[model samples]
Target: MLPPHRARRAAGLLAAGTLGLSTVFLGAIGTAQAGPTGWTFSESNSPITVPSDVCSIEWTITGGAGGFGDTNLRGQNANPRIVTTVVAPGDQYTLVPGGAGADHAAGGQGGTNTVGQGGGANGDIATGGGGGGAASLVLKNGQVFLSSLAGFGGGAGGGAGGHVPDSPSAAVITDFATTPAPGVAGPGSITGQGYACEALNTPPPAPEISVVPGPGQLSVWGRSGGPLGPGPGVAPVTGYEYSLDGGPWTTVPGGATHGMATPLLWLTGLVNGREYGVSVRVTSSAGPSAASAVKKTTPFERPGKPTGVSAKVGPSELTISWSPTAAPGTYPLTGYQVWAFHGDEVDGFQVYLCEVSASVHTCTAEVPAGVDYAVYVEGVDDKGNVGDYGWVNSAVVPLGDMPATVPAKDADLVGASGPITTVTAGKTVVLKGSGYMPNSTIRAIAYSTPTELGVFVTDENGEFEVTVTIPGDLPAGAHSLVVTGVDPQGDVRHLRVDVTVSASGTATVTEAALATTATATATATERLPNTGFSAAGPLVAGTAALGLGAGLIVASRRRPSA
Candidate 1:
């Protein structure tokens, strides 16, 4: 057979109309004018017939880069070329893009797109030089019409000196090949050249593996190096596979099969806090190698519950606080959740009060007044798992006398006294005051028994509004409530109010009046004061004697007058 270059040249001559052969038929009409169309040819060994109306073509051709070397001596890259040339209508042409050089033994030449020079080789002790990259070419009549020659790669010990294109963006033609194709021939054995190496038959060594635990998941990774050195294997590793608890092997995602070197593989849907055994192996054409030594890890779920949860009653709001000692599981702590429950434990309903970030220790929520409630706190993990609730307050009956902390000021008082304010025993009553030391704690005491009620804090204006419940067994009578706190000047401050305590569980009387009528009777008298009976008898005898004397005198006077 003729040499490769000579045969190509001879073929070109026959197709160019030089040897009286026309591979392309021309129209009888005169040369055609320019037409509106662009042509891009990329396939190797393929032909393109010039359009009947297109008189010329602006061609931009790119060459492929040389193959990568086994060592520091890399293959050189090829430069691209752009040219504008006149063409006859119906002329046949072929586009051949350059192929990348290969690092295989026997010094394989880059394929026909570009005629790459073959690489040189060493014995099994060292790898062979990468094949040189080929130049892109446009062929006519089997001859080279337009060609961009790329530099040959270094065979073994030398460095490559290849050229790079100045106008890479101007290239319109895609190169055909980057690596060697099937059945392509390598350089023939030459005298004094060492024997070429062959494909490996042994599988790759097992890889070193590690795992990180997450909530219900595990992240796994592997790298070359175990009982063997970093060389890993006699053959190229295609991928890696893993087995869980000695189960069937599963391929690692994004491994060499997906063109990744060392990808992180995740095992999900695992049980939290359960120990799992895992092993890994490398895969190659020879099949999977022995598994690596088993490693164990346990996945963690949500964090432990929070501690020291406490809720302070303040008017209609509860000031909640907690400790974060156990707020995070394996993951980071995200926040805390507060819940308020009303009624008894068996039948009550709960309300989501508020949520505060892990960094904050306190949260305030407005709640309904006068009801007994229990506040619960829980930790939230970054994975969105809420831990068990921590019970700080089991029976917190919010009263009207509870007040929130405020800033300190001067000594003062409010509603000291007025019309007797009536209050029922064993019920909540709101009392407001001002002018104590701001943000100071105070106590309310009920008299005349002087029994202590509850403690509270003042507000920024040195004011306070608190709820207090009276004692159930206190006798029904007038009483007073006194609140005492520290003044701004460190003196004791006191506020007092007079109140009438109704009978326990009863309403107080509202009216006050007096009655002014006598309740005595008189006895009847029988006679005049002293000597009553003798006086009556003498008066009667005198009346009779006087009548007798008067009759004798009248008889004597009548005789004289006659």
Candidate 2:
């Protein structure tokens, strides 16, 4: 047989013994016999080709960086005559491809690799996933779908000068090998991930902030995060602020020490209730981060009860209802809401039943019958303020039904999921003042109860809005709530809630049953008034105040100044 090197010679390629060119596979294309190491090639590699087109080059795929940004394998340094375009194989990435560090400076290295593959030409970032070289691949017929694992390595990035092992089995093409088909060979590797040189001191994997793990510190899993030495230009990580269950956001102290390293929990803090997300801002004492990843955490909150609820009796043309807001408030009474599981009542519920001075306990809705539905109600004060939905069970309603009720006097009722029954304060929180008459509403000062932090006054829709930053200096401990809501009719609504504030400034409200919660945290929140709650200091907005008053005081209070 002709010598393996001489068996597949093509026009314009370096013949054997010229330029130290050796025979190597170029991923999906056939092989070219050049010298020992001078990149033996016949022609440039196209991103794709027609199945009927002749196959000529060799091909190989390398692993790529794990996170978002792109990685490139520069072609400038490759055999100048050979043009290559790398098609990320499986879950590949290509950020700032080619060049040593960036397009602005340096050129990339060449070879096969995987996570952490291709390195910066200057070794600015870590090596590509497989440490394998990258090549841009062109799909034939345009119908090939790459595996999720097919990732892009930094294009010929820099600093990959060390001895990295390479695969030995590459297909070499003769003028006759691809006559019947296009030049391509694959369906090769069998795993989603692989690596070339795996002995380096890898950093502790970065922490994951997805909804699955429930945000906060200690959410470590996947990739890299810790004390491992920094990878090129990595910014030193300090602490981070995060949110939970989509509540207020605040940053705190804590992070891995390796500077310039890739940390999942990098710059941003955790937020509650919403799908988590992050952007690692690399920083050095020299300055802030230059390269950032605008990536959102994978959301994994459990499915909630079917939402967008409305009720109709068909006979009265009355449609009673409520909405399940994504707002981060406590249950039993999210704002002015009251709820009962379906089928708990034989009759539908009435919006209002009792009416007395100062107290709304007499205000109850009768449960309708025949149809399965939950019931709830929000208390509206005389000043037009609405309270969280309070629970009532004067009667029960079954599926597809309605019950009878004798007419009660002068009570106005709106059907709904209810109202914002209860919400605990963050170290600092926005006070939602709604539902009060324009000029007649009370100040946030009067409604400032701990368990019941009064927000802004109501609007024309009887809904008011206010953004009050909860101070971070309040005492940390398990506490209860007491709030008062005045309506347009001058009636006051009372509410009681409970919460816990950790020493590190993590605030969480407990459920009505007082169950310990692992979610819903607000770092900075204002204190609600207790019986002796002395009006502490005046409300100073936006300052990071870390000290609270000597004692808890009640009204005759100091108003929170805007």
Candidate 3:
């Protein structure tokens, strides 16, 4: 007998195709070794005879091919088996290649009574099963040397092995019989026999999904693939699977309504302003359909409020400016919205000043004067989302908010009586005023309890004629009508007319002292009468007293002595 090390060396040389070295070891062991030879068998029940000079044999065995099933359900192929066995001269062995299974028939037989059975069939519909591979066995003087049982073929629409298929094992050497070990089932081993039949139902087509983006979140809207297939076995979508950014899939139950698109899922815990890819697949009893086309969207939030806001005021125009806000996300910043509130915070009126493009940081708007305003700014995204307002500056009174002059030095007003300065109380009268800013807005105000009567726009000659109605509720007292406007130099110009207010329906012209007190406690509000004047053109650059004949005409009314 050869030493154990020499025996191992012989096996290693034999596996490496070193036949000369193996022959040396075989000669040392007193056995003449034959040159290596390979054999392939496809037929069933073939016999293999070991040469008289051989000491070992290497065998490679393969199972037979599986049969095909109807509706393009092909059977799985078998796994190959390989082993090297120590043998004596003139050893006897047999090769039983499993027979190929036929469509709608029983599976091929394996060595030692192992068989792969076929699935059930209905009329012309059939399923196939694959054949089992040959087994490996070696016996010396009734003592076991190495043995491996053959594996059964796969069943139709079942795992790679046939239904109830037995497992195969690698060759082992022992004095007694070696039990076969279990293995993971081949492809399709866990499936039912009806797995192939379910293919009659068509898969769902790729769907069109919509996405609405929000702050660090995305809302996906989708619809069902609908019922599909030609026969009664038509499959309805039972669930849906979604993937985000090409990540793992998540399954969600399907709704009852089909074909109509609606919000179905919301993906959160995402970074803002980052784009992500999304896909969906519909599932049914038949399996999952092909994935839908990829759609991309980005989550975003409203822009930050503008900072460092400031404003500069002119006669009736305000120019506002601010610093840039935070950078935009998926939705770009479209513009900035500027707003202002007139008067004190308690009773202020809000107004939308203007909108400026995101590329710009400044904008100008037309604003009414005579009252203080608080200016604010906010950012707007491309999706029309508005941000919080940045209250930068307040109490921005325009240049037209100067003190009211009791009797303007460079302005004049005349009624139908031609410069005669007597007026009745609680009556309607037409008065023409000149010597003011060209194309400027003029306000008729009643004071000591300042009340706004009407507003009018001056013509190109700095003149305007407006019909005025004295307030009927005014107590019989001395009062003055102050016509205020902005001059060409952007200075406030007030034209005052002093008069006595009498009771209604009485033309009693009472001679009263000139009212000189000017207060801002205005309480009465009235609508402006419609003036039949077209829009004024560009303002003419001239003095406010251009048409004044003598510049100062003091009309004094005296009561005649009875």
Candidate 4:
């Protein structure tokens, strides 16, 4: 049970609340003091929730009409509005309607108060003008749809004595179909509805990204965005954004579009042997697409130097050993190279002994006895990178040995006579020896000088015979001949012969001259044995006769004997 004017005000407040225009009405109305009555709507209602199926929407909205008044104080018209656009569902929006203006309060009556028991007459007071209405708006999908300006309220009637005329309201509202326009200063009223939308525009798909790793960088490429169904409405891709190792994304310049080729982008400053994860996304006029899948890769480098190189020397052989080197990248060690050098000369000729597998750490090389050598090793990786040589190792081969039992022997020298210990300058001598290593080399040399007399190989019995020509210019003195034997194992043994040489040999009878004198004596002895006289008497008689005959022959030759 409320007054008619109050009930109408309540109904207007409810309509403003339904359109979300209560806040604007509160601001438009003045303070509710004794001065004048001002119009106001209720508080704003909850926002409208759009359905998910809806893609586009159309809206038609109007502002509140101005309040009514006397002939001189007519109210203004309401604001006009309209909107249409594409939108996404599940979005919330607000709608606002204009509030009506309030009428002015009535003027107060004139009164007389007692002053010294005599009443004083006072003039009638005029009332203030009404307040203006507030503007309104309709928002769809977080965007403005239509708006209206405020309208002014009517003025109060004139008092009894001071006749104050009512003020006129603002003019009628203009068409706000194109854009939201403000309402005039008049009564507040609204009339509009929302319409269903058409189909929504399709978005582009996510890009496919790939990465290729090089020496210290990575190459990235992508493919995204294509033409729509049978029309010109093709989603256009502008560029791409990339993230490294789950870091912040960085935008690049180019991207693949409909009926276009994709380009690669090279990124540098990457560390070698490090793995990286990368992702990409494409951008278009609508918005950005989802991120692509992660791509993994790693940069590579050469292997490092080997370690723990060592060499062991055996008789006529060298054994080398070392540890395998490590690679800094994904490549694995493939093999090892073993090398040998003469001495400390590394840059000289390097003898490539052998190539061994990565698992094998040792290798052997055949070398000459009693020689010095230096060894080195290197590692090779699957990526074709050769590591530096390891530390140098010195190796020395040990000497070899000959047979035993070569020291003592049956050593003797023989000349024309049997077993001569001494010899003249022009005499020829024969040397005989036994108890030497079988199939070994035997050498006869002059002990005083470096002259080699003869060289021979021992027979199966370990015996050798060699003819040596002693130099005629050899000094006439005591000299020693050295006989040496060397076995297959490179062992050595020596025998010495002491001999004496005379300065002169003119009176010495050689073996051939002695044999001739002996033959003549044997013939004379045989003739005496045939004559039957006593062997001594015949020989004595013959000797005496030979002496007498020789004396007579001499005399006859001297005296011419008959």
The number of clashing residue pairs in each candidate reads 16, 225, 7, 18
lDDT of 1 by residue, 164-246 (tens): 33232222212332333422322211000011123346666677777655557766656533333323125556677889999
Tens digits of per-residue lDDT for model 3, 1-562: 1221221101000022222313222222122223454432322423444554454455443333344444434444544444443454465554333333343344333222122222211212223343433333332333333333334444444223222222122121111222223332222110000001122255444445666555667666665433322233334455678999888889754542332323457677878778899998776666667787888977666667788888886655668899988655346788877766543322234445777789898887665553345676767777665554566444333333323434443444445444425555567765565655455467777665766677666665556667788676777667667677655443456666566655552333333223322211122223232111111112111111011121111111111111
Kindly list the per-residue Cα lDDT of model 4 for residues 323-399, writing each as its tens digit. 77764334677777665554222212234456778899899865433334456576666655444457555543442
Worst 10 residues of 1 by lDDT: 531-540
Q: Residue 267 in candidate 2 has what lDDT? A: 26
Candidate 2 C-alpha lDDT tens digits along 311-384: 43332112334444333221121122233332112211222222223222222333222122333333332322
Candidate 3: where are CA atoms >4 Å away?
Answer: 1-207, 225-234, 245-248, 253-262, 271-274, 308-315, 319-323, 326-362, 368-376, 380-442, 445-562
Question: What TM-score against the true fold does each predicted structure earn?
Answer: 0.27, 0.20, 0.33, 0.23
Q: Root-mean-square deviation of each candidate, in angstroms?
A: 44.0, 29.5, 33.5, 50.1
* Residue 52 lDDT (model 4): 51
> Highest TM-score among the candidates is held by which one?
3
Candidate 1 residue-wise lDDT at 285 = 73
Question: Which of the predicted structures, 1 or 2, would earn the higher TM-score when compared with the native?
Answer: 1
Cα lDDT, model 3, residue 191: 7
TM-score for candidate 4:
0.23
Query: Highest lDDT among the candidates is held by which one?
Result: 1
What is the Å distance of residue 357 in model 4 from its true position?
59
